[model samples]
Every structure is written in structure tokens, then in C-alpha cells.
Target: MAEKEAVEATVTGNDQQVGFRAMVMKQAIAYNLAGSARNDANEIVHFTLQGDKHRIDSALATLQEGTKRSSDIKIATTSAAIDPGLNAFTIVDWTSSSRNITNTYNLVFELRADDTAISPTDAKAAWHQILEKTLNADDLKKLQPND
Candidate 1:
């Protein structure tokens, strides 16, 4: 049998809003690889895969392509020592971590004689409304600005 290998990768760019982690987990399971994936505060998706060398290479190719919702995805990989105890792949939720990031929405309103520029309060409200439609409650909570 071929020697097993481990790899750690960071995937960046348009990876957040999409179901990137779930997709990656599915692929990892399909390859019978063991490890975990999570989103970091910097909006990067970090993951580790360990298994047969050939399977790891194939998984890397799938990850680099990314899910349909992902765009401009770039993946960086490095060799890692395999963890003998790893048995299953999972999505690591870092919502409780201090590193959790709040998403800031900015809207620039142009002043016009016919239309008044939007007030800061109104702009903030509008931004939250957009988030409500696009993000889940948990994700919305993480986006709350620090006082």
C-alpha cells in the first residue's frame, strides 16, 4: 500500500456566504479522508486532510475548484504529519471563539437636490435588513458590531 499523507490548506475569496465547509466535508468523506474544516476570522476556509496520497491529491483538486456559490477561490496547501488518531471529518464551528468577526456594511449615499442623502442610522438599518434576508440568525448575531 502507498504511504499515507496529510495536508493543510487555506481557501480564500468569496467562500463565506456559500456552503463551502459543508461541501468540503462531503468531499472529504467521499475520499475516506479524516480531518476537519472551519472558517477563520479573516474569511478564509482552513481544512486538513489525511489519507492515502492519491486520494489526498484528488481531494485537493476538488477543493481548489470550490462549490458553485464560491467565486475567485484560491487554495494554498502545505504538507503535514498525519494524525493517527483522526477517524472522521467534521466542520468546526468557531462561532464562540473570540476571533469571530463582525461583518461591516457600508453604503455611500450621494447628495442630490431632489433627494436627501440617507442618514447614518437609516443606512445602518438598511444594511441590517439586507443581512436579514441573506444570512441566518446565528450568522447575523456574529455580525453585531462591538459596542
Candidate 2:
């Protein structure tokens, strides 16, 4: 309950990071979501996600799936409750970095749903799906430093 409103979830990946914001302003717009991205000092990224559960979900999916550069990555998600007054779901601004762990970065996200906010559990759920699409065992192994 708590009058669900927004969902702020954080993501972690390879030595780089990025975030997504600005709710799906354009009706049925392309999946090309927009926001900000950066390189954190902690080797971990910090990004935000602002949009409906579906929008954020799909975007996160992309992150998990990854691009041509990076491959499967280890991730963690922490959820936060939001207000119920937001008109539409929109990602605000993302703060990323590359110093979370060794050869890893931090990922932070702020998302909006219908009434209340999405719980960390739910956030991780969505993030988990994204990771599944993006990462694999080899990707996770290579990120490790020389043992």
C-alpha cells in the first residue's frame, strides 16, 4: 500500500554505468529511453529510472541485455517508496561511477508506477529479469581479477 507511486531501483555492472529518466513522454515512442550516464569513482554505476513499471521494466531489460561492448554482469537492486502525486513516470537524473567494487560499477534507478512505489523486492525482480537477458557465466567470470 503506502499509496504506491514511484519505483527507485539501483543497478550494478561492469566498470561503467548509466541511468534512464523522463517518463515515456511520447506516446508509444521508440524504446530509446533518455537520461544521463557517468563513470563512478567506486567502479560501480549509479543511475535512475523514471517511468511506468512497464517502461522502466523494458529499459532495465536493455541494461541487463547489454550492448555490443559489455557482456553479462553482476547486479544488485535496492528499492525505495515514492509519492502518489506524480503525474507520469519519468526518470530524473542518473549519477554513475566506476569504483563500487573491483572492476565493477554502481547502478541506481528511480522509477514511477501507478499509485505507489515499487518495493526493493519488486525492483530486484525486474532487475533480475534484465540481468538474465544481459549476462552469462563467462561474462561474470571474466570481470574477476587474476586469482
lDDT by residue (tens digit), candidate 1, 73-109: 8888899988877766666652322325343322111
| Reference-based TM-score of each model | 0.62, 0.38
Report how far off residue 6 is in candidate 2 (Å).
3.7
Lowest summed lDDT over 10 consecutive residues: which window, candidate 2? 19-28
Per TM-score, the best of the predicted structures is: 1
Task: Report the C-alpha displacement of residue 109, candidate 2, in angstroms.
Answer: 15
Give the whole-model CA lDDT for all candidates, comma-separated.
0.63, 0.36
Question: Which stretches of model 2 miss by more than 4 angstroms?
Answer: 1-5, 15-37, 83-147
Looking at model 2, residue 88 earns an lDDT score of 29
Instruction: For candidate 1, give the lDDT of residue 111.
Output: 20
